[model samples]
Target: MARKGGELEAFIAFLGGLLAAGLAALAMAGIGLAVRPTPALKSAALVTLGAIWLTVTTTVYLRIKPRSS
Candidate 1:
């Protein structure tokens, strides 16, 4: 069975992408932190990865489905 469309589906998809990207970014951060164990550098890496992931994922989603309204 598939989920019905409407706002809920879009919202869920958006959240899923964000969560996926966030997790990816966190994993990268963990690797960096493990190697150097630095606060600033780790923060930066996480932020950069998360931003990139979010941007790319959102862009892809938008391309797949434009504005709902």
Candidate 2:
């Protein structure tokens, strides 16, 4: 039972990280578009920002641990 609860908590944390990463990516993309007027530069900026966001999110998710109860 305790193991199951821990798994559930981890799953929830993972989902939350995913949602946060997605929202952040959208915001970054918008900023990239506004900052870079040229199409190529905008695309590059968006991709770079997206990759960075994903990497950070994944690292954070992996570091999350269930609390003792």
Candidate 3:
């Protein structure tokens, strides 16, 4: 049905966006390591960034409209 097709399209788009954001977050974490020379600081920064990214992605995915269908 048309509704199912639309839902599928929205789901696919959501997945694509999630993938892109994940990649970007990883790149940012890698860059963060270079910004902080101390090992402790680097670890902390990466962990914080990872946690924030996971939280944001989960929230966005949950709020995606297609799933409501």
Candidate 4:
């Protein structure tokens, strides 16, 4: 069904990616803030979480996005 409407499919994928990434970021931030570790540890934790978030988001986006014909 999605294959027939390429542009619309792509747009949907874009929105999905944005939503997924945003939610992931918020979750990570909440976790980091809730823990309230030492400054150095907090920095390291947030950085690690951010990297994981980016990787997951990009993977999702690529998996959902349609390829050019």
Best of the candidates, lDDT = 1
**Which runs of model 4 end up more than 4 angstroms from their true locations?**
1-36
Write candidate 2's Cα lDDT for 17-61 as tens digits.
667667877876777667756878668766765676567656665
Model 4 misses residue 42 by how many Å? Answer: 0.4
TM-score per prediction, in order, is 0.49, 0.49, 0.47, 0.47
State the lDDT of candidate 1 residue by residue for 35-69, as single tens digits.
97568876887677668767766665666654444
Question: Which portions of model 3 show Cα errors greater than 4 Å?
Answer: 1-5, 37-69
Candidate 1 residue spans exceeding 4 A from truth: 1-9, 66-69
Query: What C-alpha lDDT does candidate 2 achieve relative to the native structure?
Result: 0.66
Task: List per-prediction Cα lDDT, in the order shown.
Answer: 0.68, 0.66, 0.62, 0.65
Task: Estimate the Cα RMSD of every predicted model relative to the unseen true structure.
Answer: 4.9, 4.1, 4.7, 4.7
Better of 1 and 3 by lDDT: 1
Per-residue lDDT over 1-69 for candidate 3, one digit per residue giving the tens place of the 0 to 100 score: 435434655565566556756776787678776785577866776676566656655565556545543
**lDDT of candidate 3 at residue 55, scale 0 to 100:** 63
Output the worst ten-in-a-row residue range by lDDT, candidate 3.
1-10
Lowest summed lDDT window (length 10), candidate 4:
1-10
What's the CA error at residue 39 for candidate 2, in Å? 13
Q: After superposition, how far is residue 44 of candidate 3 from its true place, in Å?
A: 17
Pick by lDDT: 2 or 3, better one: 2
What are the clashing pairs of model 2? none
Candidate 3, residue 19: the lDDT equals: 73
Candidate 1, position 28, lDDT: 80
